[model samples]
Target chain A: GAGVSQSPRYKVAKRGQDVALRCDPISGHVSLFWYQQALGQGPEFLTYFQNEAQLDKSGLPSDRFFAERPEGSVSTLKIQRTQQEDSAVYLCASSRPPGEKLFFGSGTQLSVL
Target chain B: EDKVVQSPLSLVVHEGDTVTLNCSYEVTNFRSLLWYKQEKKAPTFLFMLTSSGIEKKSGRLSSILDKKELSSILNITATQTGDSAIYLCAAKGYGGATNKLIFGTGTLLAVQP
Candidate 1:
């Protein structure tokens, strides 16, 4: 599919382990977003980027949660020293500039033990 | 804080029944209201309502936004078993440099055969 692509569909890591989740947005889609969805809950915004510049990350739970879009096309969300509470599905979505609708990837289900 | 609230956390209905979902929100610089359906992994975009009073429809699904009341409603008529999924309501807000979406917990709908 030409939609957003997420890697490591599922991840299991012991507490204190660091994890990295990747997302490849649709070609030429300028706006990228990261969201966290816990079981039985809607996705919560985590960060936003436009062409390599991360403009917003106010929704990040802590400093340990860091995201970056180095080239503005691909993004990575890195969680350092993971906690059990961090278990959730991390979703990636992209939209064209002046974005009104979003295209989402299947998401990475991260499980921290 | 920007937030979206949805009513009837869960619902079960016969295949031929009609159902209505409600969503209300409060946010700074509200840009749009969006709906998505999540079956298992990816959340598929259903509708994006920006202008008030104009209802957007697609087959059995229709949605309307009300800026005066800061709310929206989604109606699905003669729903099928395939309509069983978690329906998400999100409010897009523009504050600072981010145009992020704040989502409600979601309404779980089960259309029984």
Candidate 2:
């Protein structure tokens, strides 16, 4: 792809419902990252991946938040039993080795109603 | 814990105004400082500052990092309406080679014509 791609640009989920957000990073990028942005705030790190390995998940807010990059090219963020506090924008970014520059996708705006 | 803080939660300026956005950080395993622009959903990368004193510029946008002060500043010269957005600051930590970022609450810049 020309740039990082994400699906379901907007989502509305009821509390306790499950939602899945997808990201397709630039082809062959060595590093991928997930971030969450609350209203009137900056994007915070959620997780990181190198290749197909999930090296860090320290920023995932709770057990309900889960992310995976099984094949290294595409990734998914799954939220189970979503809560109102989870309503925010989920962003995915990708970069090559050394990881100085990141190209982000359009992001998935999830609104838990 | 790694933390980044941005000042002037919101600013209103005219199209020709020159504004400076401030960011201060305290990262445990600090690597680099970064700037991003957010309009609606996605945050576009702007600058990444690792070394002190050297300023990176792209058109009217320039940024510099002061390692001694543990801070960074983003300067926008002759700002335009298109530049109206939330300017974010993030710090990359050596949590791993993957380079996850800790972001600040961001400074919202509203440029009026």
Candidate 3:
């Protein structure tokens, strides 16, 4: 089966620009998650979705960060006014349910200049 | 707040050697622990350990979870150069609308031929 897939394998944006990263979860996956990983650090939770409803966004670093899963199988993590600190690898993962093994996407490397 | 910590930031080993990675977590309503091997991109799921299944093995990889200690260990026997990558550990936090994963800093493994 195809695993989770993320688009724009790499992205480069100027500071203050807006960027939206896309994630296509595995077919029929009910749960999706987003994470950010900075160099030399582990991936940090950004948000979560169960079906088409987002249930958690506490991990989002700031108000500029937003996410949505309108169709349940696809999600997008949008960063408004990208900053240098936001330059990290944005990873997407999906699972049949919470607490189960998650399949991950290659991730979008976001570089803010 | 939940947190995951991994010991030995990095390790270097030769093919045919054995290695073990550690993960300790502090989280409320712990659901399960997971191990992943990440090369240059996404993480590849290796194992998932819950109370019901605290031990799991696959090929040269095996993992055990100690709920009482809130820790887990991943052991690889007869390591090969292909096994070189970042080993990540994550703990699932329970009792939420969506399960959230807390990740450790990860252990960088370098296998030499």
Candidate 1 backbone collisions, by pair = A52-A72
Maximum-DockQ candidate: 1
Candidates sorted on DockQ, descending: 1, 3, 2
lDDT of 3 by residue, A6-48 (tens): 9999999999999999999989889899999999899998899
Candidate 2 accuracy as TM-score: 0.96
In angstroms and one decimal each, the interface RMSD of every candidate reads 0.7, 1.3, 1.0
Error of 2 at A76 (Å): 0.8
The residue-by-residue lDDT of candidate 1 on A4-78, one tens digit each, is: 999999999999999999999999999999999999989999999988999888889999999999987889999
Residue A62 error, candidate 1, Å? 1.2
In model 1, the Cα lDDT at residue B14 comes to 97
Clashing pairs in 3: none
TM-score of each: 0.97, 0.96, 0.95
Can you rank all candidates by TM-score, best first?
Answer: 1, 2, 3
TM-score of chain B of 3: 0.95
Scored by lDDT, model 2 comes in at: 0.92
The DockQ-derived docking category for candidate 2 is medium
For residue B80, what is the lDDT in candidate 2?
98
Chain B, model 2, TM-score against the native? 0.96
Q: Report the lDDT tens digits of candidate 1 across residue range B79-107.
A: 99999999999998775787788899999
Give candidate 1's iRMS in Å, 1 decimal.
Answer: 0.7
